[model samples]
Target chain A: MRIQSLCAALAILALAGCAADPAPTEQFRLTEQALEQAKAVGATDDVPELKLAEQKFTRAQGSMADQSFKNARMRAEQAELDARLAEARVLTQKSQEQLTALDARIIRLRKQLGEVQ
Target chain B: MSVFKKLGGGLLVLGCAGLFGCASQGSESALQQANSSFQSVKDDSNVLRNAPRDVIRAGESLARADRLSNYWGSGADVRHYAYLSQRYSEIAREHSNEAMNQERLAKLELERQRLQLALREAKLLSVQQQGKWLEEQIVSLATTETDRGLVMTLGDVLFDTGEADLKSSANRTVLKLVQFLQLNPKRVVRIEGYTDSTGARQDNLQLSRARAQAVADVLIDLGIDEKRIQVEGYGDEYPVEANASERGRAKNRRVEIVFSDEKGRLGAAR
Candidate 1:
């Protein structure tokens, strides 16, 4: 009975060890890179997605400090996506502004053409 | 003791089911939302064409989320993947929009170039149609081929008294000048302004400069390159006539356009 109880205890310990996640160092690096790329593309805190990314990234860092590898990985992964979305949003807005300016120029050109005719 | 143990095991199983039930409910909704987002982006041909990789990633993430939702105690992972999938779909849509806009911008740019060319040609033709008569008038008015090169004088009558504004009567002459410069693209011009000795010297200087600038502004508006024109204010100096008589002062109050040679060799400014 003593041997059986010891075996059960060892099995539970192995299971617990298996449940614990590995430190997500690579994921953290990827998150940081994504955040930097978003900022480079003119994503400011005014952008909601960028704000979310910053908040989550900070929380992910806190989780890392606490050794909650699962939480840290999840938050960092989400943060990366948020930052990417922010960057994409900023690019889309810039392209839209360009379109508006182009449209205005075309309209002005047409008006000039009309006057000339 | 055995019956009590059986009751305890049953209660434990019930409690575990309750926890998983709540978790699965939330995870199920999140998965559904992500699936919807992915489906929309996947259906969009433009999104597929422009952001195929992102759309594929979104679908893959959504599938992972769906698979995770079937397991107990994996609710957080399911939600995280679902969120990622949704974000990817949104990013894909935005990228496709940007691509479409860029394509439209290119087409519009081409159209704009074509329209610009048409406008320029129309202007040149209109100017040429009125060219013959205006050319004669300009030759008669441009009386002097002085040492300062071909000098054409625009008299004080072209401006309102004490005002720097050119009268509408000067429009034909200005348009003709614009046409002449366009025809001789290489030729440059220096517009010099003079005022009568009636005003204060300082005032005369400012007025002369302003008048010259006014003519230059019109030339620029009519499409002459600003670099091709130089403006100067002679004030009461270098008078074509004496300041003693009103007719002489009127003659002195003038703007003279000095043209460069065919090779754009402009004479030195006086």
Candidate 2:
């Protein structure tokens, strides 16, 4: 009876093994990475009005870190919006950077042609 | 040493052959299960061909559900038979269900057509002979009973914001409702009040009950027998719309007519 019970216990463990899922750390990491990518653009026009949304998001996050899930969820939503804004800002900055690089390259080519002439 | 080695080699060959035979037999059984289930699905579809359109559609849905249910496998050869059978059974079951739905839909269509025809005839008879909106109002949302009575809805438009004060606009609505009730005096009147989820749950319930009693009070004033009226409050629990949006909340805050002798039984759609 003891041996049979051991075999049954092993079988149950095998079946239950499939349910032992890890925490969704990967999703959080992806969200964080996306957020950082969005911030690298630094294209905020820096008007006083632009600071309002950022302030709200900061407050929400502070409340969330205090172990308040309700406030955390609300802050996370705002954070997503902020991240989107950051993404747009970064995209504009990158585009401007690219244009500046192209202008420099064109100036260099023109100087080379003048020398050749 | 040579004789011992020969005997061992022969035994190993026999064991390998036996293992191979078992594998082949397992595969054959799996194939049989898969094929039988496939045939079942085919037969189910054949039934669908003659089924009405609704039945056919439901059967199609069932078939897809079956595929989803059974297609997930243990991902092993030994489990191949079970997986195949599951997949095939799902397919077959869905097809059969759809076929049945098609037939049922056809019958519903017939019933609807018959009802419509009857409605037209009733309307014509009342207009040509009696000259009125036929007292026999056929509405879909109300509950049906052996008795035909007038059904009316008086909304929060009659009340103040968050308060159950009977407003002035409520007069016209109440008057109209009163006339309907007077016309069908023997019928029962069920007054139900509902609220949006803006307030505390306890407050909402009290408000609903208050509003319901208010309506009942008005009907009683209009000469409807107090004993004939059944007043109840469902509150925000049975909202007709989602409480998230403003417009939805606006719709949620109201009193609705549930049972009309003419329309049958109507309530917040569950």
Query: Which is the leading candidate under DockQ?
Result: 1
- Measured with C-alpha atoms, the lDDT of residue B220 in candidate 2 is 91
Question: Candidate 1 lDDT, tens digit per residue, B1-270?
Answer: 667556755655675577587667777888899999999999999999999999999999999998888776577778899999999999999889989988998998998899889999998887666564555667787647889888899999999988999999999899989988887788899999999899799999999999999999999999999999999998888987889999999999999999898789999998
Give the Å shift of residue B237 in candidate 1: 33
Q: For each predicted model, how many residue pairs clash, with residues at least 3 apart or on different chains?
A: 0, 22
Q: Which lDDT tens digits does candidate 2 get at residues B14-57?
A: 75566456555544455456555555554655534532342333
Worst 10 residues of 2 chain A by lDDT: A43-52
Looking only at chain B, model 1 earns a TM-score of 0.51
Taking the true A–B contacts (Cα pairs closer than 8 Å), what share appears in each candidate? 0.71, 0.00
Poorly placed runs, candidate 1 (over 4 Å): A1-19, B1-15, B138-270
Q: Mind giving the per-residue lDDT tens digits that candidate 2 earns over A35-79?
A: 555555453526221243356456655654564544444444334
Q: Where does candidate 2 stray beyond 4 Å? A: A1-117, B1-151, B260-270
